[model samples]
Target: MQLPVETTDSINKISELRNTNLQNILKKEIDKNALWKGLVAKNLMAIGIVDLTDMSNIKYAGINDNLMMYAASLPKIAVLLASMDAIENGELEDTKEIRKDMRLMISKSNNAATTRMIDRVGYEKIEAVLRAPKHKLYDEETGGGLWVGKRYGGGGDTNREPLKNLSHAATTMQVCSFYYQLVMGNLISDERSKEMLEIMKDPALHHKFVNTLDKIAPRAKIYRKSGSWRNYHSDSALVWGPNRRYIIVALIDNDFGEKIIRDLVVPLERVMKKARNLEKETKI
Candidate 1:
């Protein structure tokens, strides 16, 4: 249970330029929207967004990011990363069957496929990938993000996540960090991270965030994972926009969770475009 001597230094040590600017802009946008305000009044929602186009001028923010919520199928992103890690460590084989299963698990959100992978790679290894010092997508300080406590199927307890004890738990900040690491080629290794991100690219499931984002930005490439179970609907993605690149994650626990995710896309895209325009103006 001990981390490396310095493991807890800080999980998101990429760039620490305070979230004030991003928060202010996002708050203004969210507050001005009537539907968004009504949705916020009803249920739990967590959001994390960052503009990756300019890492040097990294702008990022989150709302209720620390409240760990059931991430549904989203934590499968952890499984994808763990599979790559195991292959690199020789703990798990990189066979066609394994790769296919991973693809199904991710792209299709196939629970059976996910269980096969969870059994093969072992949940411990997946969590290891999250808690790894180099990655630490889920760590003690962050209250343990991206967790899979029980089997996806053939389940019994189906209880909750480990560190925080919420079934299939995730934090928006952690999910975004995972994507950030993948984009920056820091999840495992540059080569392995790219391979994993490629798997996440062009997700097969087409609802919620995918549906909304695709409608708004037809040309953009989205590497995403989403989960909709009862009242929990979650979506997170690394969006390669035509003129901007950023990461956005939403975890909503509400009756309107799906619609809420759908409604937020264009607005977030506009924020990215605005940031880009300002960047261009400064250059000019």
Candidate 2:
């Protein structure tokens, strides 16, 4: 099924969705946990959330959203977008293997499949797509967003991001913008966004955000992608349900980052719920 559009001319980009009350509620929720607050103080964890319950009046809240960190497989999303762009432009051949690999690369976070897809599209192509003005998924001027400068596996030259030299890196802000633009059907095209979302739907690995979400919102349709390597853990998802239409992105660097992300769901949900009530109060 096609995703719904959530943009007005005045608020086309995700950057335009910032809401002060939502930001305050989000901060209050995060600070309630001493350990989480400590991590925020240390710049080891970053979270970005968007309340899409009312698509016409989106609300955004974030903490250290632009603090770029090594994001491991999360940047594979850059490869995914580049591949889609190539296929659309007829710069790369669309094949059955490519389609299967795309699903595996995203749904299972398959390194071998990701590496092959990267080789098919090339790092230069991915870089161009990100740096392109239309997408700007990675921009040095904006603290450097999603980046894939090296192959997922081994045996290739490393083209690290210029700002941080991270082989693969991302910031919660950029990731949040990604899902925002994606669902808005502005990623390549509406049809392409749907295809990408199809690949991301119902992720295979159930951990971090998905692990908790599966229990709390069993019927929610979750389009997600996540990554983990050593102490670096990251998760991003556009969750669509009755009253839970929102986007959540977290990037953390700590031994307990995985658990931290899983634990963040309920509190963030509370923030969204309260934001909704605050909107209602203003209307009444």
Candidate 3:
């Protein structure tokens, strides 16, 4: 099934959806979970969730959503966006090799493919695009959002974001904004968003969020990107379901970050489900 088409007001209304009800619901869930609550207290874990079941009245909430952290390969997504921007602007050639590498880079999280794309686009291009007025994806004022300072493969360092100075860094809210914009067809353009979504569909690696999602919602269409490096683990997904739709993004720094990410799926889903139910009751 295809994603919902963008409406005339999507771009304007797509800013951040901060609803009090949803905020309380999400915060309560996290507080009840011992592991999540503790990590959140230490500012080691950040989660951003958006309930898209009612696009007209979208709801969003997060805990430590603006806390930037080392996100490993998750920020390859910034490279993907920059590539699309370059392609659309005619700054980069649209060749078969580029297309193939884009797919491998995102789907498989292949370091070699990612580094090649980064080389082609360059850190300057990525930085400009991220800080562009329309996107503000890596705004320093907002705690520095999605940023790709270093290449995926072994490299010295390109341009680490000024705020956190992490090579590959992301804040939950910023990553969430990326997915939200993509789904809204505001990333570059509608057609470009579709192309990027195609590349992200059916992630190659099946750990973290995808690991548990594979079993629980087998039929749902999931477009996701995830990463893991030593103690840092991160995952983000745009889950499109028959009855439920939402975006979930997370960044973690801990020895058990992998398990923390995997375990996050259920509670996060519950938050979405509970929010949906509450929305129904209000309507009734």
How many angstroms is residue 170 displaced in model 2 relative to the true structure, after the best TM-score fit? 0.3
- Model 2: lDDT equals 0.89
Off by over 4 Å in 2: 5-11
By TM-score: ranked, best first: 2, 3, 1
RMSD of 3: 1.5
What is the C-alpha lDDT profile of model 1 across 171-219, one tens digit per residue?
8888887887776667777778778877888898888888987777778
Off by over 4 Å in 1: 1-18, 38-43, 156-160, 275-284
Q: Pick the candidate with the highest lDDT.
A: 2
User: Candidate 3: which stretches are off by over 4 Å?
Assistant: 4-10, 13-15
Q: What TM-score quantifies how close candidate 2 is to the native fold? A: 0.97
What are the clash counts of all predictions, listed in order? 2, 0, 0
lDDT of 1: 0.76
- For each candidate, what is the lDDT? 0.76, 0.89, 0.87
Among all windows of 10 consecutive residues in model 3, the one with the lowest summed lDDT is 7-16
| Candidate 3 C-alpha lDDT tens digits along 1-284 | 98643634446423358877788889999999888899999999999998888777778888898899999999999999999999999999999999999999999999999999999999999999988877778887789888888877675557888986788989888888888888888889888988998899889899999898898888888899998989999999988878658889989889998888888889988988888788789999
Query: Which is the leading candidate under TM-score?
Result: 2
Candidate structures ordered by lDDT, highest first: 2, 3, 1
Error of model 2, residue 97, in angstroms: 0.2
State in Å the error of residue 233, model 1: 0.3
